[model samples]
Target: MPRLSTRTRLLLITTFPLLVLFVTLTWYSHQSRQEEVRAELAERGQLLAAALASSGEASLMGGQFDELKASIYGMMQGDSAIKRVTLLDASRKPLVDVEARTSGQPEARYFEAPIHKRLLYVTGGGDRNVGTMGYVQVRMSATALLAKQRRRFYIELGVASLGLLLCLSLAYRMTDGFAASLKSSMQALRAADEEKRRLLQRVNTAVEDERKSIALEIHDELNATLIAVRLEAQQITALAAQAQPAPLAGQIGDKARAITRLALGLYNSGRSLVRRLRPEVLDMLGLQGALEEMVNQYERNHPDCHFALQAQGDFAGLDGNVAISAYRIVQEALSNIVKHARARNATVALLRRDGRLEIAVADDGVGFDPAHTAEGIGIAGMKERVQALGGRFAIATANGTRIAISLPLES
Candidate 1:
C-alpha cells in the first residue's frame, strides 16, 4: 500500500479531536435547548395560573363571584389559548365553570377540553365554613410553544452541521497545501541525488583522460630517448672491439657493453612505467587490442610462461568508461600474475553477451590465499575503477587465480 503523506496524517490527527468536540458540544447544546424549552413552557403556565387565581380570589373576597365569572368568560372568548377557567369549593366541587354555558356548571364539565393534557396549575381558596368559597383553574394550549421549540432545535442542528462542514473543508485545504509542499521537497532531493551521481562520473572521466595523456608522453618521448642512447652505446662497443690496445680494448668493450645494458634497463623500466600509468593501446587499438598487447608484453618478459588472448563478439562503439575499466582490470590482473602468481600460463578473454561486457584474466599459478593476503592498494584501485564504471569485480583461486570484471553495455 502507498503511504499517507505527513500533512494528511497530521490533519487527521488534528481533525479527529475537533470532530469529537463538535459532536460533544452539539449534544450538550441540544439537551440544554430541550431543558430551556420545557422550563419556559412551565414558567408561562405558572404566570397564567397565578393571574387567574389572583383575579378569582379578589372577586371571591369582594363578594362579586358572578361578575368574576362573567369577566373570565369574556377573557376566554378573547383568547383561544385560555381553554377554560373555573372556581371550585375546597371539597373540590365546582362553584363556577366559565367555559361552560351555564354559570352553575360543575368544574368537572370544564375537563372535557383537550387543554387538560397540559395539567395547568390549580390553586385552592375557600372560607372556613360548611362549603368553601372556591378554587381557580386555568389552562392554555402548549402546541404552538412546543412547535416553536422543535423548529429552533432543527435550525440549531442545521447550523451545527454547516459549521462542521466548513471546518472539515478548511482542514482539507490545509492538508492538501502541506502535502504539495512536502512532495516538492522530496522531488528536489531526488534531483540533487541524480546530479551528484552525474558529477562523480564526470570527475572519473577527467582523471582517466589525464592518465592517458601522461602515459603517451612517457612512451613517446622518454622511452624513445632511452632507446637512442642504448643504440649509440652498442655502436661504441663494436668500434672499440675493432681498434684498441689489447688490455685497454677489453676494458673499453666491457665498459661500453655495461653502458648499453644500463641504457636498455632504463628503457624497459620507462616502458613499464608508462604502461602502468595508462595503457596507450586502450585508446589507440580498443579494449580487445589492449588486452592482446598486454598479454604479448607479458609473454615476452616471462618467456617461460604461456599467454593467450581471445575475443567472443564485436565490441565496437562500447561506452568509453566500460572499455577503460575493463582494460585496466585486465592489465592489473596480468601484472599480479607476473609479480606474485608464479604462473606458467595465463589467458585473457574479452566477450560481449546479454547486453553485458565481460573480461576475465586467469592464470595456472601457485595462487595465494585471498583471505590471508591484505587487499593492497593495487586491488583496491582496480575495484574503484570498475565501480566508477558501474561494474562488478570478482576473484577466485580454486584451481588458479582468476579475476573477472563485468560492466553494463550502456553507461
Candidate 2:
C-alpha cells in the first residue's frame, strides 16, 4: 500500500483514541449480556427444581409424576436445542431419563456415554434441612446461544466500522477545505506583490521621461536666452570702454562689473538646475567623470568636510539603469551624510568584481540606530530604487554608518 497522506495520518491519530474507547465499551457490554443470560438460565433451573420437590411421593404414586413428565416432554419437543434430561437418585442411580425426539434409543447408563458432551446439573429439592436429594442432569445444545452471540458481534462490528469511516470522511473534508483556503490566500499575496512591482516600474519610467523632457527644455530655451543676454552685455561693456568723458568711465566700469557678476550668477544657476534635472555628463563622460564632478561640487560647497571617491574598473558599458541607480544611491547617501551624519569625512567607493557591481558609502560620523533612523525618506527612497533593480541594500554601523548596495551586472 502507498503511504498515507498527512490528513489521513492526522485523522488516524485522533481516531485511535476513540477506537480504543469504543472497543472497551463493546467488550463491557458483551460481558454484561453474558452475565444476564447466565442469571436467567439459573433462575429457570431453580424454579423447575422447586416444582418437582413440591409434588412429593403421593403425587408420584397417583400417576401425577407421569403427567408432569408428559407436560415437560410436550413443552420441549419442538425445541431441538433440548438434547436430553435425566433424574438421578442420591446414590447417582438413574430414576428417569428422557431423550430428544431425534435420538432413536436411550442409553441404560449415562456413564457409558461419551464424555465430550457438556451438561448442566440441577439438584432436585427434598427438605430445607436435608442436603441435595437427587441430581437433574440436563443436556443443552449450545448452537442457539452461539448463533445469538455471533449475530450481536457482527452487528456491533458493522456499526463501529461505519462510524469510523464517517469520522474519517468528515476529517478529510475539513483538512481539504483548510488547504484550499491557504492556497488561495498565498496566490492572492503573490498577485499583490507582482502588482506592486509593476506599479513601481511604471512610476520610475514616468519620472525618467519627465526628467529628460525638463533637461531638454533647460538646454534649448533657458541656456540659449542666457547666452544672448551675455553677448548683449559684452557689447555694452565694449562700447562703455570706448565712450568719451573721463568722469563717466568709472561709472561705466562699475556698471560693466555689475552686469558681469549678474551674468555669471545666472549662468551658474542655470547650469546647476540643468544638471539636477539630468546629469548630461553621465552619458557623455561616463560614470567616473560624472561622480568626480558631483563630489568636487559637494566638497567645494562644504569646505569644512572632506569627501573622497574611488572607482575600480571602467563602467562605460554598464546598463543605463545600473549606472543611474548607482549614481542616485550615491547622491542620496551623500545628501544624508551632510544632513544627518555630522561627519568630518565621508568616502564613496564603486567596484566591479565577478560580474557584479558594489557601491559603498561610509562616514566617520555619530551613527544612530538603523531601525530607528530608517524613517528618513531619502534613505527609504534609495532602498526602494535599489531593490526595484533586483539589488541588495544594507546599512550597518560598527564604528560609523556604512550603506552598501550590490547589483548583478545583467540587471
The per-model lDDT (C-alpha) reads 0.73, 0.72
Query: CA lDDT of 245 in candidate 2?
Result: 88
The TM-score of predicted model 2 comes to 0.54
Clashes of each: 0, 0
Deviation (Å) of 54 in candidate 1: 73
The 10 consecutive residues of candidate 2 with the worst lDDT sum are 109-118
Q: Pick out the ten consecutive residues of candidate 1 with the lowest summed lDDT.
A: 109-118
**Model 1, 56-140: lDDT tens per residue?**
6556656677888777777766644455676665556766665633322222222221111112334664333232345566654
lDDT of 2 by residue, 295-383 (tens): 99889998767999999986879988778778888998899889978899999998988788899999998888865754688888887
Name the best candidate (by lDDT).
1
Q: How well does each candidate superpose onto the true structure, as a TM-score?
A: 0.44, 0.54
